[model samples]
Target: MKLISTSNYEKLSQQAGEEIISRIKRNPTLNLGLATGSTPTGLYQELIKDHKQHKTSYKEINTFNLDEYIGISKKDRNSYHYFMCEHLFEHIDIPLDQTHIPDGTAKDLDEECSRYEQFINEHGGIDLQILGIGQNGHIGFNEPGTPFDSRTHIIDLAESTRKANSRFFESLDDVPKQAITMGIASIMDSKEIFLLVSGASKAKALATLMNGDVREDFPASALKNHGNVTIFADKDATALL
Candidate 1:
């Protein structure tokens, strides 16, 4: 694991953007694993700027998102699908056909999970994965205590997670209580991983990730077992480290 701490969020986003753009230049058909939420919004904006300014082509890039709320439709504003389209996908040249996100409204969610897992395997796994750690140390929607060996599966959102996400909804009750997320093992399969951390809200979690034992109680600790993990963080997030 490698840690690169920047002075602030903008610098962090710019540096991370450079790394991603370089990778895309090297392999236009790169299979990218993406994450949603505010932590990555800046990075997405930077990518958009690059696309407009330098014409960084994403026409052949294949993107797979990390997770989605179980009860929401793709059109729902809060859905990860909508989030991607708003934040990154629609702005880039990547084809909608090549962008993959788990179907949260599938009648047979178990089958959907299987299909998602198989789809990733068929594409030769993720070449690069971008991740953001939750305040409770969760990755994707894999809350605390999720087995590190787990795969793509359904998860009951932890109370802390739901509360954290409530800001996006009108109220806490409006938040989805369940989600489908790629598991730790699924994430570990990526050839390279970039873990982005920002703001003081994540300071303690980042501290735990750096100092705590490799236990399932703190999900991000699982990254310690991966060989090619690089952490891009801002001073606020790394304050306690």
Candidate 2:
């Protein structure tokens, strides 16, 4: 694992964007693992700007989002699918079919999970993965204490996660307590991983992860064992490190 202290949020976003740019430049069809939430919003904006200014088109890039709120319709404002297009896809050149976000309203959730994994497997796994850590060390909604051996599945949102995510909803009850997320096993399969962390609230989690041993209690700790994971942090987020 490599630790990168970014100058600021903009720099962090660019670093993350450059990761995808490098991969896209190397192979237009690079399979990308993506994350949602405020942390990655800046990175998405940067990619869109790069596409406009530098013509870094995503015409053939294959993207697989990390997670989505269960039971939320794709048209819902808070859905990951909605977030992707509103933030990045609509402004870029990525083919609609090349982007994959788990359908939140699937009638058979199990079948949806299976197909998602299969789709990724047939694509030769993710070439580059971008992640944003939950305040409790969760990644892709695989909350704290999630088994490292687990696979893609439906999971109840942790209280803290729900509370943190509630900002997007009008009320706490409006926040879906369940979500479908890509498992750590699949995330670990990526050839390269970039873990982007920011905000003062994330300080404790970041510090704990940087200081703690590799344990199941804090799922993000598992990244320490991955050979190609890079962690980028703003000064406040890395203060405890």
Tens-digit lDDT string for candidate 2 (115-204): 898889998999889999999999999998889987788889999999999999999999998998998888888899999999788889
Clashing residue pairs, backbone N/CA/C < 3 A, model 1: none
lDDT of 1 by residue, 1-241 (tens): 9999999999999999999999999999999999998999999999999999999999989999999999999999999999999999999899899999999999999999999999999999999999999999999999999999999999999998999999999999999999999999999999999999999999999999999999999999999999999999999999998
TM-score of each: 0.99, 0.98
**Superposition TM-score, candidate 2 onto the true structure:** 0.98
The best candidate in terms of lDDT: 1
What stretches of model 1 exceed 4 Å from their correct place? none
